[model samples]
Target: MNHKYIAFETIVIKEIRRFARIWLQTLVPPAMMIGLYFVIFGNLVGRRIGEMGGYQYMEFIVPGLIMMSVIQNSYSNVVSSFFSHKFQHSIEELLVSPVPNYVILCGFVAGGMARGLGVGIIVTLMSLFFVDLAIQNLAITIAVVLLTSIVFSLAGFINALFANSFDDISIVPTFVLTPLIYLGGVFYSVELLPPFWKFVSGLNPIFYMVNTFRYGILGTSDVDIVWAFLILLLFITLLYICCIVLLRRGTGLRS
Candidate 1:
């Protein structure tokens, strides 16, 4: 095998093992949190609300919740792991190596995607306990989730590249990512919103992701799935370019 492929595989395996070893911290907490959401929001509040888009409220929110877990875990894995390597000055080993920039970027992005999808699967199984999830379109469900994971993974990579401190790595997810996911139609459909508010919600990119994934599972959506797929592709391309440029420049990786 080529050395570059070996290097890429090494980085990905190291990242996977790093998070797996800390499964209590990395995996179990998200599962517990989603369970609470299922109990409180899915059972208690959802009962009062009734159906959303012809499915029970719990069923409706399943996709969004799963997507939410994917977005958070994937982004967190890459940003925190990459930033730690940078902090420990261990990233210089890869920077000084002959591995191509794309390989290096993809290795980390793959790591992020792995964690994101891993948590997503766990949450999806947890959802099955709360609601009988009959996937409306299996292909779309997988495609949307995979694309969403890639977009956030790339976004996380860029965030890590620009992050100078640990706080910098976290500020975006807390302030920006959390708000967007909350407003992204996790609990309620945007069709219920007033015109002005609906127009505003249209601007949140995460909205498209949540709704599209919801459509995949429920066969109903507020936005066009094609448009959502296009937007996801655009973001992935742009973020990939941005991450590659930062890697080439050694943005936060360089002292």
Candidate 2:
């Protein structure tokens, strides 16, 4: 194997092991937290709301919740892992190595993807306990999930690149990500929103992601699935370019 492949694989393995060794923090909480969303939001509150988009409210939220889990986990894994290395001053070790910048970026992004997909799978399995999920299009479902993971993973890397402290890594998720997910039609549909609010919700990119995944799972959607996908790809390209630029500049790593 080439040295670049070796370096990439090593970083990937290291990141995977780092999170796997702390399963309680990395994996278990998402499962339990999403379980509560199902029990409280899906079973308890959803019962009062009846059908959303012609399906049980619980059923309607499943795809969104799964997407939520994926977005959070993928972003968190890269941000925290990379920031931790920065904090420890160990990132310089990689910087001094012969590994290319894209290789380094890919390794971290792949690690993020692994954890994101892992949590998504776990949440999907747990969701089955609440409602039966039927995939309207398996290809779209997989493609959206994969693309969403890559987008957030790249975003997380950018966040990490500019992060100067541990708190910086967290600010985006708490203030930005959480709000986007909640207002992204996770618990309700945009069609139910009034005209003005519906237009407003359309501005949130997460809205597209949740609706696309929902269409894949339930065969129902308020947004055009093709447009949702195109928007997703567009964001992925933008974020990837931003990450590459930051990496090449050695923005946060050199300091």
lDDT (Cα atoms) of all candidates against the true structure: 0.92, 0.94
TM-score of each: 0.98, 0.98
- lDDT string for model 1 (1-255, tens) is 999899999999999999999999999999889889998999999999899878888998889999999999999999999989888989888888898999988899899999999999999999989989889999999998888888998898888888889999999999999999999999889999999999999999999999999888889999999999999999999999998888778787765
RMSD of each: 0.9, 0.9
Write the residue-wise lDDT of candidate 2 on 75-113 in tens digits: 999999999999999998999999899999999999999
Span of ten consecutive residues with least summed lDDT in model 1: 246-255
lDDT of model number 2: 0.94
Off by over 4 Å in 1: none
Candidate 2: give the clashing pairs.
none
